[model samples]
Target: MGLTSTASASSEPYGHYYDEYSTVVDVTDVGADATGNEPITPVLEELRDDDTLLVFPEGRYYMDEQFRFTGFENFGVVGENATLVPANYYDFAGPQYRLFRLGVSYSPGDRIRFEGFDVDQTAPDTGIRTIEAYAAERLEVRDVTIHGQHDSGTWGPGMFNVTDPDGTGLVDQFRAPDGGAWINDTPTAGDRWRGPIGIVANQNEGTLEFRHCWLGAFPDNGLYAANGNGKIIVHGGLYRNSNGANVRVGGNGSEIRWPTVEVDSTRPEDRSQRGIRIENGRNITIHGAAVTITEPEPTSHAISVMNTCESARIENTRLELQGEDVNHGIVLSPDCGEATIADTTIAHETAGGYPFWIQDSDRTDRILAEHVTITGAAGDAGGFRDGIRCERNNCRFNYVDIEQPGRSGVNRNAIVNTANELTVYESNLRASQHPYIDIGANALVRDSALESSSGREAVCLYASSTGPAFKKNRLAQGIRDLGATDVTTWANTYE
Candidate 1:
C-alpha cells in the first residue's frame, strides 16, 4: 500500500514505510498488551517523544474508550491484520470519545502518522475517527481499514454522531431495521444516533489525506470533514455498506481550499449510502471515481451536490441500481455554484427517474452538461421522464442522449428547461411519447433532434416570442409560441 503524500519516501521495498523507521514500539510490549481488555492509554503515554507504535503482526486488539494522546512529534502507529476494538460501543455514541486525538491543544506543535491497521468499534453506535489535525501539518492515514456495522438495532454504527443524541442512549435498545437492534421511531433519529465516518477535521489549515483505506457504515454518514479551511484530499479507498451518506465536505470563508475526494466503489451494492454530498464549499473536484447505491430491491439516487458550491466537476463514473422507485441518479443544486458533468454513463436505473436533476440552485450560468448518456432497460414500460432536468438560468447542454421506453405518459418530460437564458444544442431527445423538449422561458433550442410521439410537438416552447429564440430543431412539429396559433419556422429540417 502506498502512503498519501509519502509515496516517494521509498524506505521499505514492501509493506509500510514505518518498517524502515527503527524507532518503533510494540503497544503490547510497552504494557498496552494488544490482547488485554484494558485501554491502550497507559502504553501510549510511555512512548518517546518521537516513536512508531506497532501492533498485531497478525492479531487483534480491542479499545473501549476514545484513543487519547498528547506530547508526541512525528508519532507513528502501524499495524497489519490487527484490530483496535473499542471497550464499549456506548463510549463513542453519546459521549463521543474520539478513537485518537492527534495534535492536542496543549501540544500544538506535533505530528502523527497511522498506517496499515484495522480499526473498528466494539459496539455498533461507536464511530471510528482517525485524528483531528488541529494546527498540525503533514499528517497521513494510509493503508488502514476503519470498520463498523450499521447494526440497525444499534444507536450508531461506524462513524461519529455529532448531532443531538437520540431517545435511546444505548445501541442495543434503539429500533430501526436491517442492520442493528436500535432503530429509532422518529425520522430524524436515524442519523442522529448512528454516527458517520469517524475521521473529522475542524477549523484546521493544514494538509490532510487518507489513502488506500475502507471507510463507512454509520447512521448519519460515512465521513464528515467540516469546518475545514485548508487542503484535503482522499484517493484509492473503498466506501461501502454504510448507513447514511458516504462523505460530507464544507467550511467557512472563501480562501479557495483544494479538497478532492475520489472513492472506488468496488463492493457489493449493499455496502453504502449516498455517493458524495458537498454543502457550503468551493474549489471542489470529484473525478476519476465511481458511485453506486445498490440495495433495497432497486437502488436510489447515486450522488447529490447542493448548498452553494463552485468550480465542481463530476466525470468518469457509473451508478447501478439497488431498489425500486429510487429517483434522480444525480441531484445538483449548486445555487450560484458552477459545475460540469461530462463523459459519465448512468444506466440500469429501473425507476423512471431523472439521471441529472438540477433545480433552483444559485448560479444558473456556467453549467456544462456534455457527452452523458442515460438509458433504461427494455420491457421497462415507462415514459414522461427526463434525462436531464434543469430549472436554472444560463445553462448549456450539448451532445447528450436521453432515451426512455414506452410512450410519453402524462408524468414525463424528457428534457425540462425553466432557466431564463438556456441553450440546448447537438443533443438527441428521444422520448417514446409526448414532447421531447419542454421549454419554460427565454431559452434557445439549436441543432437538436426532438423526437417524440406522432402529432405531438417536438419542442413545446411555452415562452413568448420576445422571451427567447427557438432555431435549428428537427422535429415532427415546429416551435409553438405560448398562446399563439402561428408556429415559427426555423432553419431546422424536419425529419
Candidate 2:
C-alpha cells in the first residue's frame, strides 16, 4: 500500500483505488457475487500475477465467459460502482467474443491498468465486445463507459480492440455511445461485426493516446488506426454519427490534435459519412479540425487524403457545409504524395463539390495551398461548384481566396487549371460564370484578383495554353486567347 491516490474521493459510493505492490484482491472477499447473477469469471481467474491489485467494490458484475488476461506484469483493475454485463451473443463463449481479453497476441506485457468501469451493453439482440487488449507495454484505460445498441449481427461487439506494438498507451475519459448497425441482416459469409469500432488501435507499435474521448454512432470508424507502425494521438475528441470516417489514419505518424467531427443529417443511413480519413499515411497531421457535414446527400468528403499519402498536412482546418449534397472540401487522391494545406477554411452553405480537388493522379506531386479560404453559396441552381479543381501537377496557390456567388454553366470554374506547373499568387478569384482563370499549360497569374461578375472571359486561354502568364493582374473581364501561343500579358488591369 505504499502507492495511494487512485482518485475517487467523492462521487457517491464508487470509484476508488490504491496500489503500491501490497497486493489487494477484494472480489467480494473471495466468494464473488455483486448481485449480478453469480459467476464473476471464477473470482477473476484467481488473481496474483506479480504485483496484483483488483478491486471492484460497488455492484453488478456478470460476465458469462471470455474474460481472459494472460501473462501479466504489474496488473491493476480498480472500479468503484463497477458494472460489466455480457452474456447474450448466442450466450457467448466461443471464438474469442470478448468482454475483456487483455494482453497476449504476440505476448508482451508490462504495467497494464484498467480503471473505473461501466460496460452495460443495453442487452436486446446484444452482440458484445467491450474490450480486447494485447501486447501491452504500459497500457492504461481510464474512466470507461460503453452503453448498448451496437446493432448486433455482423459478428457483433466492438468498442475497443487495442494492440500495443512496442509500449506507451493511454485512453482517458472514454465513452462509446450506442454504436451498432447492420439491422436488416447480412454477415453469414465469414461473420464481421467488429466494424462499428469506437476506439481501435490494432497493429500498434507504440505511443497510442486518445484523451477526453466521446465517440458515438459508429458504423465503421470513429477514432481508428490500421497498419500501425506506431504514433497515434488524438488529443481532445468528440466524434459523432459515424458510418465510415470520423477520424481515420492508416497510422504512420498520425496526429489529429483538436477533433470535433460531426455528421448527423437526420441519419440518412449516414450518407456515406466522412469527416477525416487519411489512408496509407506517412506524416499525417490534421491540426485544429472542426469538420461538419449536415448530410443532405453527402456521399463523403470533408477531408480525404487518399491512398499513397506521404507528407500530408492540413493545418488549422475548418470545413463546414450544412447540407444540400455536400461532397468535397479537400480531396487529393490518385496516389497522393506531397501535400500541405495551411491555415485552411473551406466553407460552403450547400456544397456542389470542389473546394480543392486535385485529381488526374499521375502519382500527384507538389500541392501547396497557403492561407486558404474558399467560400461559396448563391442559390444553387445546379448547386455552386468549382473553387479549385486542378489536374494535379506541381500546384501552388498562395494567399488564396476563391469566392463563388452562383451561375457558371458548363462545368463551372473559379480556378480550374488542368495541371502543368500551375501557380497563382496573391489570389482572390471571384466567379459568376466564364473562366476566372481556366488556363491549361505552365500557368501563372501574379498579384491576382480576377473578378467575374458575369464573365465572358478573364483568362480562358485553352489551346494547350503554353507558358501563359498574366502579370500584375486585376482583371474584371478580358483575355480569352483561345488559340493560345506563348501568351504573356504584363502589368494587366482590365476593366
Candidate 3:
C-alpha cells in the first residue's frame, strides 16, 4: 500500500513522510536490532533514496550484508511480522549476494514497493536472491512469504527477480514453498540442483503480471520468461513439484491462465517434469489449464508447444495422467508454427506415450485439432500407446475422440499418420491393438468412425500410400492397402 508523490516544498513536518514526501524510517529509530544480532546495513543505507518508507515493525531483521537499493523514485518497504533472516553462507558478506537489491544497472526507476515480508531462507545455505528488481517503472511485490531451502550454490534463493524493460508489474500474493532443494555436493554438479527458478521475468517491455501465486518445489522452472519482447501474464496459480517446466513462457506474447499443475514422482532426481512450456512464442495462449501427472516418469509432457512457436492456442485444457510412465499429452515439436487445439480433455492411466505428439523435424504447417478428447488406460502387456501421433503436414482432426482400452502393444496405432496432408473429420477412433486409421500419403477419411475391436485393420495404408480417400466411413474392421497406388473406397460400410 504505497504510491503517493505530490508534496514538494521540502516536505517534512513530522516523520513517516508527513504528507506524501515519504520518510517513515523505523528500524528502531536508526539504531537497528531485532534480536538476531545487529547489522541492518547501515540503517538500510541511510534510508536509501531518502524518500523512503522502510518500516519493519514486529521481529527478526538480521542481515549480515547485502540490502543495497540504488536510485529510487517512490520507494516503500513495509513489513509486519517481519522476518528476513540470512547469515550463514560462511557468515555472510560475500561477493554480491542478495536479499533485496532493487534498481541499479541501466538505472531507471519509478514507484518500487515490497509489502508484508517473510524471507526465511530456512537458516544457512543462503545462495541469496529473494527480491532483485532492476530498472523499475512500476514494480509492486505484494504479500510475500518465502521459506527455506533454495538449495544454495548456482544462484538459488527462491523468489522474484524482475528485470524491467519499460516495465509494468504486479506480483501479487506470492508464496514460495521450499523451492529447489539441492544441498550442494560438488562433483561437477550434474543436475545443478535443478536451477532455482520460481518467478523470473527478464527483459520485460511493459506488462508482467503474475497474480495469486503459490509455487512449491521448483526444480528448474515454476514460472519463467526468457528472451523478452514483452507480455508475460500467468494469472491464478498453484504450481508444484517441478523438475523442469511448470510454466515457461519465452516472451513475444505470453499467457498461462487458471493454472493448477501438480506432478508427482516425488523428485526422482526430477524425472523431466513438464506442464506448460511454450518456447519461442508468438501469440501463445493456454487457457484453463489443469494438468495432473501423478507418479509417472520418462519425460513428462502435458503441454509443450516447442521452439519457433507461432499462432499457438490450447483451449479448455484438462490433461491427466496417473502412473505407468506418462509421456506426451500435447507436444508439437520440430519447427512448430501454426497450432490450435480446442476443447481438450486428454486422460491417461497406464499410458506409455502419445495422446497427441506431432513431431517430424522441419515439416509443420497447419495442425488444427478440434473438440479433442483422448483417453487411455491399457498397460499390463501392451501399454496404452498412440492416440494421435501425426508427423506434421496439413493436419486437421475435427470432432476428434480417441479411446485406447486394454491390449495393444508394438506400436498400437489409434491414429498415426506419417504426414502428407491428412484430415479425419468427425472422428471417433477406438483401438485395442493396432489399426484405427494409420495412414501415409495424402489421406482423408470424412465422416469417420473407425474401431479396431481387437486389431487387424480398420484402415491401414502403408507401403508408400497414395491419394487415399474413404468418404462416409464407419468401419468396424477391414480396409488394408499394403501396396497402395491410389486407393479410394467411397461410402464405406464394412462390418
What ranking of all candidate models by TM-score puts the best one first? 1, 3, 2
lDDT tens digits, residue span 18-104, model 1: 554546545566566566466665556556455444444555665654555556556666665667775544443333445565555
lDDT string for model 3 (196-298, tens) is 6777775676678888888876667777775577778888778877777878886777888888888875675676788888877688888989988876566
lDDT of 2 at 311: 75
- Superposed Cα deviation of residue 190, candidate 2 (Å): 42
| Candidate 1 C-alpha error for residue 103, in Å | 1.9
lDDT, ranked from best to worst: 3, 2, 1
User: For every candidate structure, what is the RMSD over all alpha carbons to the true structure, in angstroms?
Assistant: 8.4, 15.3, 14.6
Clash pairs, candidate 3, are 122-148
In terms of TM-score, which candidate is stronger, 1 or 3? Answer: 1
Better of 2 and 3 by TM-score: 3
- Which residue pairs clash within candidate 2? 15-80, 128-157, 150-180, 154-192, 154-193, 155-193, 166-205
**CA-RMSD of model 2:** 15.3
The lDDT for every candidate, in the order shown, is 0.52, 0.71, 0.72
TM per candidate = 0.74, 0.41, 0.42
Choose 2 or 3, whichever is better by lDDT.
Answer: 3
**Candidate 3: residue 163 Cα off by (Å):** 6.1
